[model samples]
Target: MASAVLYGPLFLQLPADLVLYLCREHLRPASAAALSLTCKSLFVLVFAGTRPGFNGGTQRRDLQLLLEKDLGHAPLPRRRVLLGSGFSIGYRSVRLAMNRHFLGAPNGLPLRYFDVQGISLGPLRWFEKWSARILQGELFLSARRTMCGSAWTDEALRAALDHEGPRYDICGHVSMSGPWSISNVTALHSAAVSASTSARAPVVLVPCRDLVEACGRCLTDYTTTVERRVRPVQGGGVDGRQTMEYWFITITSFHRLGSGRSPWDAKWQAFGGRPSISTIRLRRDMETHPPGAVKAAWDEGEQAAVSGHRRSHSSPTWRAC
Candidate 1:
C-alpha cells in the first residue's frame, strides 16, 4: 500500500525516464538492475548518463588537505628517487584525491597517494592496459606517467617490453640506472647492434659531454662498465683520452644507425635529417657518422693526415717549390 502511493505520484508527475533514473541511482544496488528492467527509460539514464558531478572540483585534492582540514598541518611531499646530480624522480601525493574523484566518492579523505622510490609493476601494467583499452581516453597519460620510474630491474623491464598488448618502451629509462655504463663496451656494443637489428629499436638518449674525459670516469666506474668495454674496441690503439673520445663518437654513430638512417651518409647530411640541436658540432665532418660511414671516412682522413704529417716532417730539408 505504501509502495503504491510512492510509485503512483512518480507515474503522474515525472517522466518515465526520470522516474526510472531516480530509482536506479537511489535504489539498493541489487534492486537497481531490476528497476531498470521494469522500464528502458531508467536503464539508459542510469547506465549511459554522464558521470554525476561531485560538488566542486576540489573533491579530489589528495590527502594533504584531509589532514589539514580534519587533522592538522602535515609534512610536504618528499623526494623519493634521487638520481645524482641535478636529476631526481619523485611521486605525486595528490593522486589519492584524483582517484577518489574518479570514483565519485566524497572528497577530502586522507588516502595513500604517493609511493616514493617504489616501482610498482602491477599499477604500471594496469595503466598501460587501460590506456590502450580506452584509446585516447582520459587517464591515459596519468597511467603512463605513474608507470615511469628511474630504478628498474632488467628482468622486470624485459617483461614490460615483452608485453605486446601495449608498449611504453621502458628501455630508455632502464639504460639510465646506475648500471649499464659504457665500461662493458662489448656488451654495450652488442646491445646497440641488436637494437639496430630489431624492427623497432629503442632510442638511447645520452647526455652530451666531452668524449675522452667522460669515458675516464665511465671506464673506472662499475656502473659505467659497459662504456669502458665498448670504447676500447671501437677506439683502437689511441691514448686513454683519445680512446674515450673515439668511443663516445662510436656510440653516437651506433645510435644514429638504429634510428633508421643510412650508415653510409655523410655526417652533415645525416645531421640535417636527424633531430639534433644547434649547439652540437661534429669535430670532423663525419665523426658521428654511422659505423659504415665512420669507418670509410676514418680511412680517408687517416691517409690524408698521415701523409700531410710525413710531408711536413720531411719538408724541413727541402727547398721551397
Candidate 2:
C-alpha cells in the first residue's frame, strides 16, 4: 500500500458542492474563518460566496426564503453549540461570542455548549435566561494559559467585561493546558448535567481575574521566555504523546502560586454569595464520543432536540439564576 498522503481522497475527490454544504452545515464560525485562509479556492468558496443567493435590502428575508426552499419550512431554530478540541486556543472567543449573542439578542439565542476536556464552561445558563456577571482579574492569568503569545489589550478585555450583567449566565474555564492539573478528557467523563445544587439550573464557572493576578507567576515564567522548543515525547509514534513544554512550565509555576491561598478566596463577592471563583476547577466529563454525541446531561426535552427524535417548537434548555 502506498503510504503517501493522498489529496485525492482527502480533498480533490470530494465533490466541491458537497464540501461547501458540509462547511456551511457543520463547521463552527471560527472554523469557517480558518478554512477561509487556507488557499484561494477555499477562500472564494467559503468566504466570498458565503452570502450568495441573497441580494439587496431584504437580507434577513432573503435568507429565510433561501433556507426555506433548501432546508424546508420547519427549519430547526438556529441554536449555537460551541464545539472544539479542549479549548486550548480560539474556543474562548468563540464561546464568548456565543454568550454575547445569547445575551445581546434574547429573541434568537443559540444553545451554547463548550466541548473541551477537563474545562467546564460553567453552568448552562442559556436554559436559565440569566444575565452574566464579570469578575475582575489580572490580564495574564485571567485568560487561558494558552493565550501567552496573544496580544489582547487591557482595553479590549475591559470592554468585554463591561457589558456583562446578571441576566446572562457567564461561565469561563481554564483551557486544557493551564497550570491547573486536571485532565480535561477525564473530567468530561464524570461531569453530570443531571442537576446542580439548584434544580433545572445550568452550571457556569466564572474565572476571577483577581486570582489570575495573584497567579501571574504561572504566566510570566512560561510565556516570557524567548526560547521555544518542540513538545516533549515520552514514547513511540502511534501511542507517542507530545506535551508542550512551555505549558508544563506554566502549570508548575501556577501550582506554586496556589500553595497559600484556598480556592475559595477568589470569587465574585458582589453578588451576595456565589461560588468562589478559584473553587471552580477545570474538571468536567468531556470524553471523546463519536462525531455528534452529547456531553452535558440532557433532559427529555433537550435530548429530543439533540437526537433529532422530535420536531416541535420549544424554548432553549437554559434559564438564568
Candidate 3:
C-alpha cells in the first residue's frame, strides 16, 4: 500500500531516466548516497545495475573507461578491500587536494609522472623539530614586522609579536640502527649510487646543515668525481643577524652505456650526462611572510628559476662557461 502511494502519479511525473541522469550529473557523491537511501525505488534505480562486472553493455563500458581515466583505477572489490564505503570518491578527492597543495595546479593533475626516490632523516621527526623552533617566539617579531609593515608598529601587532619562548623537555640521543644517518656523507653518496643503478629515476638527498657543510668540505675528496653548484641568498634571521645560506644538492640519473661500469664509475657518470640539476636555496626570513604566502612565493620562484636554468643550460653539463 505504501509502495503504491509513493510510486503513484507523483513519482511517475518525472521519468526514471531523467531522475537518474540528474543524480549522476548534478549531485555530489554524498548527496547521491542520501537520495538512494530515501526509498527502495531510488536505490534500485541508481546502484542495482552498477555492481562490479555487471555489464549494461555500451553504457557501462563507457562509464568504466571515464572512471579509470579520472581516478587512475577502479575501486577494489568490497570483500577484498579494507576501505569503507565511498572509497573511490574519497580517494579521488584526497588525491586532488594533495596535488593542489603540493604542486599548485588548479586541476590537480600532474604534467608528468616519474618514480622519484628520496632519502631523508625521518620527515615526521624533522617536522616536529621545525614546529618546536617556530613556537619559540624568537621569529615572531620579525614575522610581524615583515608581513604587517607599518602596522607592526601599532600596539596590536606589537602585542601579538611580543612573547617569551616556551620551554620543553629535550629527549636524549639514542644511537639506534638506521639505514643512513644525515651526518655521514659517505653513506649519503653510497645510497645515491645504489638508487641510480637500481632505478632510472632521479635520486634526491635531503640532509641537515651540518651534513650539507660536511659534503661541501669533502666534495673533492670523494673517490668518484662529483659536480657541485652553489646558489646563495641573503635574508634576516630571528636573532637580527643577516645571514647568507646556500643549497647543496646532488642529483643522480642513469644513462645507457655500451658496457656496465663498476659502482664507482657509475656514480661519477651519473652526474655527467644530466643537462641541468634542479636545486632550491630558501631565504631564512621566509617566516616573515603571511601564512601560506611564503610557501606559494617560494614554489613559484623555485619553478621559475629551475625552468630558466634548464633553458640556459641545455647542453650536456651544467658548468658555467
Candidate 4:
C-alpha cells in the first residue's frame, strides 16, 4: 500500500514507448533491485529486458531476474596455505566485483534488501526470506600434518574434515614419532621437570575461538603437524635408575587452508592452483593458550640427545592462517 501511495497511479500510467527514454541506463545490480520495489509497474520496467519471455508478471519472474547478476565477493585476498604445504603454483582465480551481496552485508544488513532512498524498509514479515539468502553455503576449513611436504589440495582436506563428523564437532589426534622411550604425545605444561609422570597428560587443544565462535562461520575442520624434532624437555635428577630422560612436545601451532577467501581478494586454491605471489613465507605466529588441567610432566635421567639426534628447542615455523 505504501508503494502504491509512493508511486501512485499517475506514474504507472506512463506510455510503454516513453519508458525506455525515462528509465536510467546501466543501473547497478543493487540499485536496480531497489528501483524495482517502487511498485509492480517499476519492477517490470527495470527487469523487462533481462529474460527472453519475462512477461513482467508474477513475483516469481521478478526473483529469477534479480539472481542473474553476481553479488558479494572479496576485493583483495591473502593467499591461503594448507599448513605444511606451499602455495599452488598455477591456478585460475577471479574476484567478484563487490563484497556485500551474499554472506553478511555492510551495516549487517540482510541479503536482497530492496528499499527506496528515503522510503521505509518494507514489512517485517519478509525477514525470513532475506535471512535464507545470506550465506553462500558453507566454507570448509581443515588442518593436517604431513610426513615431509604436504601439498594436499583443498578438496581432499575438505572431504577429510567432513568425514570426521558433522560440522563443528571435529576432534583429531596427532601422534609423535621419536625414540621408544618417549613416543607418546604429551600436552605442554608449565610444571617443572620434577613433576611426576605417573599419569599421562592429556594434550588438550585450547581453541582459539570457543565452540560457539569457531562454529559460527561454518569454518571448522581438523589437520595436524608432526613436531618430530620439537621435544620440550628439561633435565631432572636420575629417577628409578633411569639412564636417560625422554619427553613429548606439545602441539603449539595450528593452521588451515582451502575453500575460502582471504582478507584480500585471493581465493583459497587447491594444490597446483593459483598463487598471489610467487615468493612465499610461513612466519610463525606464536599463539599461546591457557594451561590445560593435565599437569606438566617429563621423563628423567636422559642424555641431551635422544637416539643420537639432538632435540630442537625451536617451535615449528609453520604459518598461522
Model 1 regions more than 4 Å off: 1-97, 100-137, 140-321
* Model 3 clashing residue pairs (backbone): none
- The parts of candidate 4 lying over 4 Å away from their true place are 1-42, 49-244, 250-265, 270-321
lDDT of model 2 at position 152: 28
Give the best candidate by TM-score.
4
lDDT of 3 by residue, 1-321 (tens): 676677664554588899878887997554565666567777788778763333355444434323432333333222211111111112233233233334354434331221212222321111111110111111100000001122122233222222211211010110111222222333233344355543555333223221111122111111112222333335655565564333222311111111111212221222122222321121112234322332333345547778989999887657788
Pairwise lDDT winner, candidates 3 and 4: 3
Model 1 agreement with the true structure over 1-321: per-residue lDDT tens digits: 676577643453577566656665676443454444455555565556654223354432322233333112344444332122121212222322233334434432233322212232332322221110111111111111222222334344433333322222221112222233322333223344455554564433232332221111100111122221223235554353433221221221111111111222332122222324431332222333322442233345547768989888884556788
Q: After superposition, how far is residue 108 of candidate 3 from its true place, in Å?
A: 22
